[model samples]
Target: MNTYTRTHLAFSMLLSIAGLSLPLGAQAADRMAGKMDTDGDGKVSAAEHAVAAKAMFERMDADKDGYVTAAEMDASHAAMKKDGQATDSPMSSADKIKAVDRDGDGKISATEHEAGSKSMFGKMDGDMDGYVTAAEMEAGHKATMGGKK
Candidate 1:
């Protein structure tokens, strides 16, 4: 198989191991925050959030090309679905990439991903604290989902 196929398979396996099968909603956000809580302190610190974002970017960069194209993002979401994981987000792959695609490249560079992730972290940190609680994460998720439950 090609690198893309292999990467998708690997990501699917990881999803299976993690048993992540929820849509991108409040529940998923809470679970994601819980996983990012490396210290198990009932919240996610900025460092922990950054680590998670980097890992996610690596996984989405299926070709290891240091950038994530819309096709790669779609493939990653497909892999998640194949693994019984639900990535039900309102934004399309292209739209997601566009949201963070600096320079209008239609792809996400590592720097762009980090900047977007940092911005998201700031949004999720409701109280302007350096950490995000599950409740805050849920609220942020809902807001991003346009208040969808």
Candidate 2:
């Protein structure tokens, strides 16, 4: 093949790979939507939201005080590490808890967790119509990976 043809082919391949990636926030949002939609209701009512929210709250509430303080989250993180369940990279567990806590109270209440999940859901919804279509979810996932539409 000609050098020019080879270069063009390589560029095309690169573009194709790039098109398959997406942004982190968008990808996480899409994943959260799929996981949280337990009943396949297409929408997350407070009732349905409570199920996942409660689980997260329980996970973070080390003291079993019905609250998830930063301390509790830290303990949870340490346990995950002990079990080899935590990610190896430097995505600090503390940072994640801080980001999701929102109120700066050092705790992630059920309400707070639900709010965070809802915010992510809104991002994945894409069309701002309150419901996330399958296309939007896939697009968000792709965007998170920096891939093509």
Each model's Cα RMSD: 9.2, 13.2
Tell me which residue pairs clash in candidate 1: none
- Stretches of model 2 off by over 4 angstroms after superposition: 1-35, 40-50, 74-90, 133-149
Where model 1 places Cα greater than 4 Å from the true spot, the runs are 1-27
TM-score of each: 0.80, 0.49
Backbone collisions counted per model: 0, 16
Give the alpha carbon lDDT tens digit for every residue of 1-149 in model 2.
56544333322221111121223245444455556577776554445444655665677677777666556655655665587443232223344445555577765566666665555455556777766644665664454334533
Error of 1 at 74 (Å): 0.5
Please tell me which predicted candidate would have the highest lDDT against the true structure. 1
